[model samples]
Target: MYVYDEFDRAFLAERVAEFRDQVARRLSGALSEDEFKPLRLMNGVYLQLHAYMLRVAIPYGTLSSDQLRRLAYVARTYDRGYGHFTTRQNIQFNWIKLEDLPDAMAALAEVGVHGIQTSGNCIRNVTTDQWAGATPQEFDDPRIWAEILRQYSTLHPEFTYLPRKFKIAITAAPKDRAATKVHDVGLRLHRNEAGELGFEVLVGGGLGRTPFVGKSVRAFLPARHLLSYIEAIMRVYNQYGRRDNIYKARIKILVHEIGAEAFAKAVEAEWEAIRDGALHLSDEIIADIRSRFLYPDFQPRADQPAALATALEDPAFAAWHRNSVHPHKVPGHAIVTVSLKAIGAPPGDATADQMEVVAALADDFGWREIRVGHEQNLCLPNVAQEDLPAIWRRLEAAGLATPNVNHISDIIACPGLDYCALANARAIPVAQEIAKRFADLERSRTIGRLHVNISGCINACGHHHVGHIGILGVEKNGQEFYQITLGGRADEHAQLGTLLGPAVSYEQVPGLIEDVVDTYIELRAGPDELFIDTVARLGVEPFKERVYAAH
Candidate 1:
């Protein structure tokens, strides 16, 4: 967690003051809805179906105990006693009143969090691996560069109003937990053949009406040249990216129109012009940023043996340990994922009390730090293995200990017609229905590593494009119908899913999904073969045939 410096605090104060004035003007009728649209959007406020939705950025998905408490307070006092964690590693308060937004902003600023650049057609939140510093296989902490990009892109005059919204993600681990391949710009930190740390840059990766796995623009870029190289990419996009149609405005469209080679050439020409500019980070600046991300004090202990012993005796704890707990870089420590996907609950909704409970747990056992995963789960990143049982008990009491990480029940779904104005059908209920269908923990585990993602529309906010089994809500004739996709994955071998078949009525979704799952189970070589691996091996035809057979 990078603490805000004086410059950062001062900047936030001024920005909040400016937003407060704007919000007051809008409420007082000094500015009409048309006039206030962009202004409110710049502050991460959206006029949703029923009320205003305030999206607060959790930069790179990191949160301190104090910040988590403040968020819980916001959920308690301002909105409906809960907030929805989103796929972009942000949180949304759906019942925000137009007038109370400034107060909410002030409270967020008090905790060094804000909603700036969260909603606009500008550089949005810079995200990275949730286990950035703690992942053992990482080349370096990708958050260092993610934070650097945040500082550089925030309110940058050159990129404040891009042709369309841009998203950037970085990942240092060999496994792409950050979904880097589906971002506008993806940076993979790696050691080159020369054993020097640098980046493998990918551009034009995005999902919407058009989905693309971004192309490799730079095979290797030196670490020090990150900012300058990114600037070059932005310059190319800003100058040539379409402005006539919103559909064609994203950098991905530009890259698609002009081939990847030409796009890379354009970026290279721009990079050559500004390679030695002020944006290049010096050794001292890089070291200072790296120093801010100090590793937590981890005690040396032999607790894993005890943990294993406990797991052997208790099936309940064993199930949780198997699904929710992840290996940490430090021995005798683990990363415990606090699942938000309890049965019948909206995928990412966490009540204020639950948030507080998580905050307290983090304070007591997790180095007072928390992380929001891209899968809409909270993580206690530095929990000692010796303390897993105690932490699991508390989380279990709080209803946060759902042992369904990567299970079929651990679904990712967006606030569809329930909250989002752009949605066509209900996503939450579909997710809820499916979750209840697979609520049997034993059954879900037996199914093995199935990811179900739902989005109300083509915006793909739920990241449905990358799920092993993706459900997309759409309007067909006058009825709500759901479309399914298979084999999509967001990892080192990222690929968009193939559509299974025709859209099925909402009532048919759960059964249809079961059919697909049954097909996978029957076709799979063994129980150990994941749904994705089975789909990859057999292709989508078998699943599609079974899902559409009755229809």
Candidate 2:
């Protein structure tokens, strides 16, 4: 984790003080709601349908146990007894009082966390593979560049207010766990033929009303010229991106309007003038940033064959071991995902007590570190294999051990009309209904490796565009309805899903989904064939026919 230096501390203190003053003025009637909107947004505060919502950034989704405890404290003291982890790997408190926001910001600052740049048209939190440092297949820790980009983008005067909000994601692994194809700017770190490290830069990828997979603008951008190249891209977008229409304001829209080749040429022309300027990163600075991310001392341990034997005996443990535990680079260790998608609960939400329990478990068994995945699950990245049973027991007792990672029950849903002002229908209840519909562990296992994402609206905050089964909520004739899509994926071979059929009523959503799953099962060649592979093989026509016919 990157520790805050004196400059970092001082900068955050100044931001807090400024926001405090702004809030005081608003309360004193010196500022109207309209006048204070941008100010509150800049600080990651939003007035939602019911109450104020505060989003706190968790850079690269890394947190210390102490930091986790601090978040729990905030949930317990300031708002409701729970917080929602978002698809962006950030957390949102949905019930904050307007007057207590500054105090909340101060509390977060005490633990080296902040909500800066979490909202309002600038680059948001730079995310990477949650298993960055621990994964064996990665070329290097992607967080190295994520941190560098965060530092460079934070409060950059030229980019403080863009035509629209921008997002950047980085990954060094062969797998696209970071969903690189769906970001405003996606950087894939790779080695060239000469064995020199560089980046494969992609631009224009985004999901909203108009979804697009980013195009590769540069086959290879030198590692040293990252900042310069990014600046060039920003300059191009800032100058020509749509400003009159909010829907087309994103860089993705600009890239789509202009050809990718022309966009690439424009960026290259801008880069040529500034590639060797002060923005170029030096080798020394890169090394210094790399040094700050020291890995924990992993002691050699023998594999626990007894735990494997126990898995054979207990079907519950076996299911958990298969789904929750991931392979680790270190011997006799594993990465455990604490599923927030327990049956009938809102996806990605954790109570204050649950947060405290996770913190304690991390301190005791996970080297005092915790990670949040873009899937909205908590990860103990370095748990020893021998300790799996005890950890599973503890998590199960706390209702955190659902063992449904990448399965039908592990849904990803947004706050929707339940909390978000931009939403058309309630998303959380839809997700909860679906989870409850597939509550049988054996049934979910049979369904196998499915991602069901629901977004309340076209904002795509829930990333519905990329799920294997994407459910989008819309309003028709003053009633809530859902439009379904199939075959979307966010992996190495990313593609946007195609619409399945006409919008169905909220009452028909769960049954429609069940029909889709049943169609996949009937058409699949074998049990090993995933829902996505089946969809790809047979296309959406088969599933669409069954869903609509059943309804």
Candidate 3:
């Protein structure tokens, strides 16, 4: 975790005070709703269908226990008893009172947290792999660069008001857990033949009404030139990105229109102009940034404890271990994903009580640290293998241990028509119903790694374009209907899903999903074949035929 310095504290204080005054003005009628819109958005506040929503940034998805406790306090005191963790690894409070906005910001500031850049037509939160530091396969920690970007872009005058919201994601691992392909700018940290670290930069990737998998603009950019090259990309976007229509404003549109080759050429010219400029990161600066991040002290343990092996005898424990547990870089350690998507519950939501329980878990079993994953789950990144049973018991009791990571029920759904004014259909009920349809734990496991992402609209907030089974809510003849897509994935081999058939009524969704899964089961080579693998082997035609045949 990166601790806030004195400068960070002062900046947050100033920003909070500024927003406080703005909020007061709006409440006092000095500022009208239209006048307050951008101001509120800049501060991460949104006026949703029912109430004000506040999105707080969890940069790179890392949180100390104290920070987690502060978030829990805010959820308990300011809004509803729970908050929604988003696909981008940030958290949202859907029922924030307008007047309490400043107070909430001030409270969050006390723990080096804020809602800055969470919304608006600016560079949003810089996200990275949730398993950044702990994952074994990573070449280096991507959080270091994410933090560097955070500092550089926080209030960068040049990019403060881009044509549209800009997102950048980085991953050090070979596995694209960060969904780099779907970001405005995706940086993959890897080495060239010489074994020197650098980034494989991708641009023009995004999802909305129009979706694009980012194209590689640079095969190998030296790590030291990261900032300059990124600035070059930003400069290109700011210079030529559309400003006439919001729909065509994103960099992806520009990249698509101009073509990746021309975009790369323009970016290259800009990079040549500033590659050695002030933005160039030096070795000392990189080291300084690295020092700011906290790393856990690990004791040398060559093997897992005997208790862990014994605990595997319990069927429930064994199931959880198989599903929730992941490999860690440290010996005798594991990364445990606490599934927020319990069957029949809204995905990514955690009650204040559950938040506190997770905080306690971080303190007791984990290294007093927690990570918010892109999959809308909480991660204990530094848990000892010996303590898995104890952690599992606690999580199970808290209703946090569903053992459904990467499974059908571990859905990613947005706050659709239920909360968003922009939504066309209700996503929560459909997601809930679908989860209920597959409530059997063993059945879900047998079904295997199926990512069902749902969005209320075409904004793609739930990342529906990249789910194994994507359900997008649409309005037809003034009725809620869903358009389904199959075979989409957000991993290293990221690809947009193919549309199955015509939009189906909300009542047909759960059954449609069930039919698709059944079709996969019937067609798959074996139980070990993943849903994605099966979809790749045989395209969406098979699943589409089965789903629409019944519908």
Candidate 4:
């Protein structure tokens, strides 16, 4: 968890005050929507279809108990009774009133959270591997560097009003849980042959209208010069990143226009000019940041074979183990996912009550910390196997014990045209509808591993372009339409999804998905065949024949 400094706290408070006045002016008719639009967006407030949508930043996707509770409070008091968690790990309250936004920001500030820099064409929140410290494969905790850079990039004067929004993702782990390749700037931490740690920097990687995996610019950037090195890249981007055309502004476009090697040379020249300056990390700062993120002590113990078998036999615990738990680095301890998806419930929606329960559970069970995943789930990273039964009951009561993690119905979705002005269709209801369609536990489990990513629009906030069954919503004569894609994966083996055929009517989606999944079941080589693998082997022809042949 990133601790807020005095400057950080004061800065949030001041920003809140400024936004409060702006909101007041808008209400008093001194400012019109035209005048207040940019100001509201700067504070992560956007006017949506039916109401105001507030996007709160969960930096590096880490949250404290206090912050979670405050988020819950905001959900209950200012907006609806629940908040929607996004694939990017940020939470959005769908029905906020603009007048209450400043008060909301003030409440978030009290807990060291804010919505600043979450929207608009600026450096957005830095997202990392959800299993940052806990995952075994990680070489170094990327959250440490994410926090360091979060502070450095917050409201940077030089690049706040760029041509379009900017995003950066970092991962120390080799498994690529952060989806590093699909970011504006992707950083992978590795050690050179000489045992010196540095980053393999990739620039100009993003997914939107144009999807391009980031390419390597600097193969090795030493650890100590992280901030300076990143500064150099940003300086290069700030100078050359297109400001003329909104569609062609991201660094990926620049990289494509001039090529990766050319971009690398420019960044190197920029690094030579301003490195080792005020932006560079000092030894003390690095130590301070690193200490804050140090892993908690773990007790070495072997699992009791007899007792373990007994627990796994229990129905509730069996479901949880099957769905929500992962093997911990420590023996006998398991990383538990408190599923935010309940049948008929919104995919990542959690009530304030649920938030408090999760927070208390983190302190009591997970060593006082919680992690928000890119898939919109929360993980308690240090639960002993023994404590899982009690957790299941508590989570069951809180309505967060849904036993779907990466299963067929554990879908990722965006706040579509329902709550986002930029969106073209309604995504939340579709996700909810799909969950309801496959509400049967045995059916979803039988279908096996499937990733269904939904985006309300082509803006691609939902990452629909990269789902095993990707669905993009389009406007057809003013009615909602959806296009499906097969074979997308967001992993070390990252591959973009391919379009199946023409757009399907919105009403035809759930049945279409069911047909595709049913086809996978009928045509599978065995139960071991995943949805993506089946698509890869047989190609889209099989699924497409089943889908569009009837249409």
Off by over 4 Å in 1: 303-308
Worst 10 residues of 2 by lDDT: 303-312
Q: Judge candidate 3 at residue 471 and give its lDDT.
A: 93
- Candidate 3 segments exceeding 4 Å error: none
lDDT tens digits by residue: candidate 1, 1-551: 77778887787888999999998898899999999999989989999999999999999999999999999999999999999999899999999898888898899898899999998889999988888888788999888999899889999999999999999999998899999999999999999899989999999999888989999999999999999999999999999999999989999899999999999999999999899889889999998887877568988967586766765478888889888888888888888899999999999999999999999998899888999988999999898888888898899999999898889989999999999999988999999999999999879978999999999998889889999999898998868998899999988899999999888889999999988988888999999999999999989998877768856
The global C-alpha lDDT for each of the candidates, from Candidate 1 onward, is 0.91, 0.92, 0.93, 0.85
* Ten-residue region with minimum lDDT total, candidate 4: 300-309
Indicate whether candidate 1 or candidate 3 has the larger TM-score.
3
**CA RMSD for every model?**
1.1, 1.1, 0.9, 1.9
- Cand. 1 TM to true fold: 0.98
Q: Please give the ranking of all candidate structures by lDDT, highest first, separated by commas.
A: 3, 2, 1, 4
Q: Over the stretch 35-128, how does candidate 2's per-residue lDDT look in tens digits? A: 9999999989999999999999999999998989999999999999999999898999999898999998998887788999999999999988
Residue pairs in collision within model 2: none
Query: Which whole-number lDDT from 0 to 100 does residue 319 have in model 2?
Result: 83
Top TM-score prediction, candidate number: 3
Report the lDDT tens digits of candidate 4 across residue range 55-136: 9999998888778888989988898788988877899898988778888889999988999998998899999988877777
> How does each model score on TM-score?
0.98, 0.98, 0.99, 0.95
Model 2 alpha-carbon miss at residue 166, Å? 0.3
Q: After superposition, how far is residue 277 of candidate 4 from its true place, in Å?
A: 3.8
